[model samples]
Target: MRNFLYGAITSAAIATLTVSTLTVAPALSAERLSLSTWGSPAHYQVAEFVPMFKQLLEEKSDGDIRLKTFEGGEMVKQQFVATAVPQGTIDISLTTLDNWSGRVADVGILTTPLWDKSMEWTRDNLKPGNPVFDYFDAKLRDEGAIIIAMFDIGAPVVSTSFEITGPEAFANMPIRAYSKGSAQVLQTLGAAPTIMGVGDVYSGLQRGTVKGAMGGLGGAVGLKHYEVTSNMFVPNGVMGTLIHAYVMNKAKFEGMSPENQKILMEAAAEARDHMQQVAIDQLASLLDTVRENGNTVTIVEPGSPTWEAFAKQLEPLAREATQSYPQEVQDLIAAD
Candidate 1:
């Protein structure tokens, strides 16, 4: 699979950009940027947001700007997207900030458990002018990428055959985690947490390689995770909201005309708003579908044994993870 994926990506790279020189050139006329993503075609990020983004870019640029899209890891792997975009392997890519940890370890701090659980809070605070945005911009600039916009998955839950309502329930249960911070928190809570990309999780669950995963309902539905797991334990923002940013190559962005740059940023913001609403409106209905499909939904209360276990195990870890981040950044996440 790895060989096939690599071969496909190499072929796609060659086909996408037929440049003879080592330095990649950004076209001023009829600009065609390669936009890659790891999202499923059905996922809102792909289905709703990306299409809107493409439409907006084309219309706003009078068809001068075009996107050459490659979805679902066909062009670049999820974890390597940050690197790929900056190195001119791809012009733009969308991925979670947590996945940027390999290049910028400070990004892991942004996933500190139970930090900014409210989707609205995330939306308002992560806008282009906000401190969170500034921090992320500086971080991404340092990593050779620039933030186009931010979108999210609300509080992630654990889907398993058995209930994991409390820390005691975590014993011996292997939980699939996507980020280093979440894995550490789950490990602190006594679960055996293993890292896996979202694309490989369904097979992992099927083979019992992992009993369950920490993921959003939207993501579970998108990936058919509910087909394999029986129960979803919602530990009230236990893992916080999942924040994904649309990031582009810094140099590529710099090469764009100021007017084109404005259009890109505006379009990204518009698409971000639409994606957030789609996610918010679809979540409850999606959860209902999960219930109708014969899975149990367990919503853990704030003061329950499960919640207490999370506070005891996950809270301190959150604090530890964000210790080096700016005080305001810490305060923004810690605020009620």
Candidate 2:
């Protein structure tokens, strides 16, 4: 009876082992992919994306393609993603156009209100027309790089946990601004626009340094800035986050098999689409959550004379900034 019981246990264990081995674990091929994001792992901007993308890519590739990820500024400095990925320091990443705006002024134009209205404009233009991507793709190659996907997932808005009831209420506070346009827009409203990155906004609030920062509702809710500042203003400001690119060092990209190249491009497209959907679908709901948490949402009236005056105050500067670009670039962006 004892021998029979032992044999029964052994048989069960062997059966489990066989089932596990038969499940087809992920296989790492010689080729690997690397990804980098702009901020710390705890920051919701990048964290919310990693799992979704990893699953999408790994599953799509059937585990033969491995993605090695680095978070924050470690993989590549926040400002160097565009230059570095093409130079082979990192394989891919969600690079901010504003970070290296100096190097790629045209790309920066896309991120600012100057180029597009929202993430939807970015996705739509690139999905089929791809005019913007084509324009910048030429520019990127000139800079020793290739941009596989360009989707503006960054939906920058103003959020302060307290009430920024109207334009006048925030006119004089030290608000953190990520882009030059966001800063200038705030300045036009009579606010002290301080330039800083998104990661710093939460800390800036904690230290009593910045009243608010211009970013998306996802960021405001995810970063817990709602805990400090309770007001979120809409149409006050919104910049479509320029995008993430599935960039590969030019030589490395060229080195891959045709099949692998196709997979990489497809993965990039999927990731870009995912980011756009998240930004568009979730932003209002995120704002709602912010309101539920005791914050207020106010939409600056676009047709009001006051709004017209406010826009007039800032329009010339926007026009002047665009003049430095190529003529065609200007013509393409000028409001028709």
lDDT of 1 by residue, 18-80 (tens): 763333443355778888888467877777788999999999988878988888888887777
lDDT of each: 0.79, 0.66
Error of 2 at 25 (Å): 15
lDDT of 1: 0.79
lDDT of 2 by residue, 1-336 (tens): 999999999999999998876675435243687878765465334665566667766677776677788876667765567678767888776666555566677665654446645566666666524555667777766766677766555546677645664557666888888666457667766889888766678889878788777765565677777778767776533323435554556677777788777777787677667766766777667777877888777766556665565456667656765765676665665532
Off by over 4 Å in 1: 1-28, 303-305, 322-328, 331-336
What is the model-wide C-alpha lDDT for candidate 2? 0.66
What CA RMSD would candidate 2 show?
6.2
Candidate 2 colliding pairs, count: 13
